[model samples]
Target: MRGGKALKHYVVDAYSTIEQNRLYYLRSHQENLWSELYYGLTDDFNRVDVTGDNVGHVVLPSSYTGSPRYMKQLYLDAMVVVHHHGSPDLFITFTCNS
Candidate 1:
């Protein structure tokens, strides 16, 4: 491990930094080398839906654990689980009065 990062964590962190840079570059320009590959081999779905021509997008990070996208994924997954197993039998919340 270098700089306290394990080998696997290093790769993940490195990739995340690279991705953050890539997204920043894409959004910084009207068009870029990256954009040329938007629907080509170096591709995935758009991070955001564009409504106008020649628009830009900011790629969401690889994970958006508490963001809208995360919530949507959670909701969809919950619906699927409930559909197969029925709704959960109990729902509970723990609170601290302080």
Candidate 2:
């Protein structure tokens, strides 16, 4: 990690069930380039449907064809590096709009 100030963007993804009401993927957004991983109770009602003592799995829709509503929260977090020497390995890069 560099000592100077750096630009950062954080994206988080959590999965929970209706019955357990557990929230997973509790972590810092800066450390990982990919979205955080979370696990929740299977019976979570707010996020999942629980039936027969089983909880449903919740996941972000990466792609959708029927409706755009499914992917309202799925996205990537990108940022630019301010001052740095040479180049450092990066997991995410900002796309310049021309």
Candidate 3:
């Protein structure tokens, strides 16, 4: 739960949008873990993909294996792009190797 709040804050700071922040939270944490769980619990949430729509939650596959440093860097890069694009929205696609 603490992890989820911390992650949510990071996402909110990165995206500066409530919807995007919630999306990131949905993707990163379990349904039971989040306080304001959106969409539903224990089922995949269908995300909106149109331009300017908030990118909803995502779940990475269990097979991803990347160093925490690398994952953080990747997330940071994505944040930069989102900040630049002003959307901070993305579909969660699990990379084969993180």
Using lDDT as the measure, the top candidate is: 1
Give all TM-scores, in the order shown: 0.37, 0.16, 0.25
Query: In candidate 2, which residue pairs get closer than 3 Å at backbone N, Cα or C atoms, i.e. clash?
Result: 17-44, 18-43, 18-44, 18-45, 19-43, 19-44, 25-38, 42-55
lDDT of 1 by residue, 1-98 (tens): 35565787888989899877865654575334334423322333454454685344454322434545567668988999999999789999999988
Error of 3 at 85 (Å): 0.7
Task: Show where candidate 3 strays beyond 4 Å.
Answer: 1-65, 88-98
Q: Which tens-of-lDDT digit does each residue in 1-98 have in candidate 2?
A: 55333322211122214212322331222234234332332233455544765433344223322223234323211112323343456868689979
Residue 76's lDDT in candidate 3: 88
Query: How much is 80 displaced in model 2, in angstroms?
Result: 20
Better of 2 and 3 by TM-score: 3
Give the Cα error of residue 28 in candidate 3, in Å.
33
What ranking emerges by TM-score with the best candidate at the front?
Answer: 1, 3, 2
Q: Which candidate model has the greater lDDT, 2 or 3?
A: 3
lDDT of 3: 0.56
What TM-score does structure 1 among the candidates reach?
A: 0.37
User: Model 2 — which ten-residue stretch has the worst lDDT?
Assistant: 7-16
With candidate 1 superimposed using the best TM-score fit, by how many Å does residue 89's alpha carbon deviate from the native? Answer: 3.1
Mark the regions of model 1 whose C-alpha exceeds 4 Å error after superposition: 1-54
